[model samples]
Target: MTEDSASMAITLSEQDKTTLRIAAYGSVTLLSAAGAAGGSPHKIATTGSIALGSATGLVGHVLAEYPKSKELNGRSVADIADRVLPALTAAMSLLKEQAPEEAENFRSTVITAIESATHHGQPGPVVADMIRKITKALDAA
Candidate 1:
């Protein structure tokens, strides 16, 4: 957390933190899964996760803590999206309502992670589409 965020009056509940964590991390997971058929899913996941871990500010504080929530269980990509997409929207809504700067930080962090997950060159059609959905969800709030 930065000095600015630390000085803010914002106080998020545990569940809210969990939602943020899930929303951010699950995005990387989605990209990894989407690229599974064409390339190295593990590489995508690792690169994206590293990006998330590199986040800063209040969003960084929230993401640094491992979330204990079990709501991310999804046997398929569709199942995962069903949970993550809404979580992303919810997280943005919550943050924007309380701390608008943090909201932007979170958005940039996730977008950076998504871009890093591609690991060079342009993203494929499927990954690009998934990225669109993720961005849409984030902006939905």
Candidate 2:
């Protein structure tokens, strides 16, 4: 058999598998929220549920991945929040296109989350950049 035809298997540790799953689920969930945020009340409800579920999954994944490292877990959570903020700002912008007041609410919610995530210390350049981008988006929305 050719190399392409031969049976090929790859293995990952359980932790690695779980991490991959969590990342995939988180991305899909966030994308779905962004797509649905401009729709009706039912769609908003669905998006909210998915967002909460994804947050829970992330918490569990962080706990599993850094069971004995508080500092690591905190840093990981902050990094994740930073990464997610842009997508979230885009989603809020979509919501703004549909409902301006509700979009403002969403912006406030995001600002609160960002503040909570970064309140422990001064944000570095990366986190500050994310905050600036998010603020500009929210303001323009």
Candidate 3:
């Protein structure tokens, strides 16, 4: 993380840090799927690269604050989906405007990721609720 990034994350609580991590992970996953969704590679690459850069920065911020640990990381992922739902909604809205087909692709990719995350154990009501919320957001977008 850059000095600025590290500084910005210093004041965040653990929950906030977890939310940032989840949002960044979601952004990267969606953008990667978008890049592969058959389009002008140049356009997708341009947009994906820019968005990935920002998302990676946030990921770095979270990582700097909390080093990777399976226990903490697992719990964080389990707790993060609902908290980051709004961020995901906003991202879906933007992608829908900029690249409608890719938006759908991104939404599916996110759902898959969420499902995979839940496979290890049951996600709490929050994760289940966020999945529905994300589905609605993506459909509306």
Q: What does the lDDT come to for candidate 1?
A: 0.87
lDDT agreement with native, every candidate = 0.87, 0.40, 0.44
TM-score of each prediction: 0.91, 0.37, 0.39
For model 1, how does the per-residue alpha-carbon lDDT over 45-87 read when each residue is reduced to its tens digit?
Answer: 8999899999887888788875554666689999989989999
- Note the residue pairs that clash in candidate 1: none
Compare the candidates by lDDT and give the number of the best one: 1
RMSD of 1: 2.0
Off by over 4 Å in 1: 1-9
lDDT of 3 by residue, 2-98 (tens): 6445444435456554543444354333333333333332443344334434322333344334223332232343343443455566556654554
Model 3 lowest lDDT segment of ten: 66-75
Provide the global lDDT of candidate 3 against the true structure: 0.44
List the candidate 3 regions with Cα displacement exceeding 4 Å. 1-83, 121-126
Residue-level lDDT of model 2, residues 1-99, one tens digit each, is 532222112233454334333332333233333333333324433443344333322232321342122211224434544444444445555545544
